[model samples]
Target: MTCQRGWQLAVLMFFPLFLAACAQTPGKGGEVPSAPPPPTVDNAQSSGDEAACRLDDIQYAVGMPLGDPSSDALARQGGAEQVRVLRPGEAATMDHRPGRLNIHLDDNDVIEELRCG
Candidate 1:
């Protein structure tokens, strides 16, 4: 009948529309939510204008913000090694041998001052 044809056409049209909508990510309550701000760290604690110092097997800097270890064996032995500027995905080693004024993430995990000779 005429009514059946109209219903079928409506269903066909609405199905495609519904699929298209489902493909997209819906916002909170059908509304786009505001993005949260990035977490920040205190820069004061980091090595401020400190020179990168490499000593013996240990390496570190004068002002590199260091993650205070919770009383570990290394601390008990004598003192843990120092921290120095390093590549984003690399460790502070002789091989890496970061040069002066190397852009690196600070001890606090935020990009800050670089190391210098």
Candidate 2:
């Protein structure tokens, strides 16, 4: 019928426009959104002395259990402004900070490595 043919023709004409509207053009809605900036270290939590963190001083804590009462004391011994305790398979930021002490723990909750980040 003529009505059927007209409906088909209208669909054919508008389908491309619908698809074009969905298409993203660069600098319009097509541009990839920028990634958020990396987090900034909180100065209030830092000792403000970058040179205070000494990895060698806390090397002895490598084999110690994280839950031990002395663990906190040991971390402070390194004079780091911030202490980050990382467990096995834990995710941590890669940002480097001279005053940050990173304590890498094993699966058994034991300190595996002590380093300055």
Model 2, residue 101: distance off in Å is 0.5
Q: Which regions of candidate 2 fall more than 4 Å away from where they truly are?
A: 1-49, 69-71
* Candidate 2, pairs of clashing residues: 97-117
What tens digits encode model 1's per-residue C-alpha lDDT throughout 1-117?
A: 999999999999899888987786769789866779999966563444433432222223324443432212212232333334454667554433222333355446543443333
lDDT of 1 at 78: 23
The lDDT per prediction is 0.45, 0.78
Which one wins on TM-score? 2
Candidate 2 residues 1-117, lDDT tens each?
A: 999999999999999999999985666567865769999867764466476588777677678788772656765788777888888777899988887788888888888888887
Q: Superposing every Cα of model 1 onto the true structure, what RMSD results?
A: 13.6
Q: Against the hidden true structure, what lDDT does model 2 obtain? A: 0.78
| Residue-level error in angstroms, candidate 1, position 83 | 7.4
Q: TM-score, each model?
A: 0.22, 0.55
Q: How much does each candidate deviate from the true structure in C-alpha RMSD?
A: 13.6, 6.6
The alpha-carbon lDDT assigned to residue 101 of candidate 2 equals 81
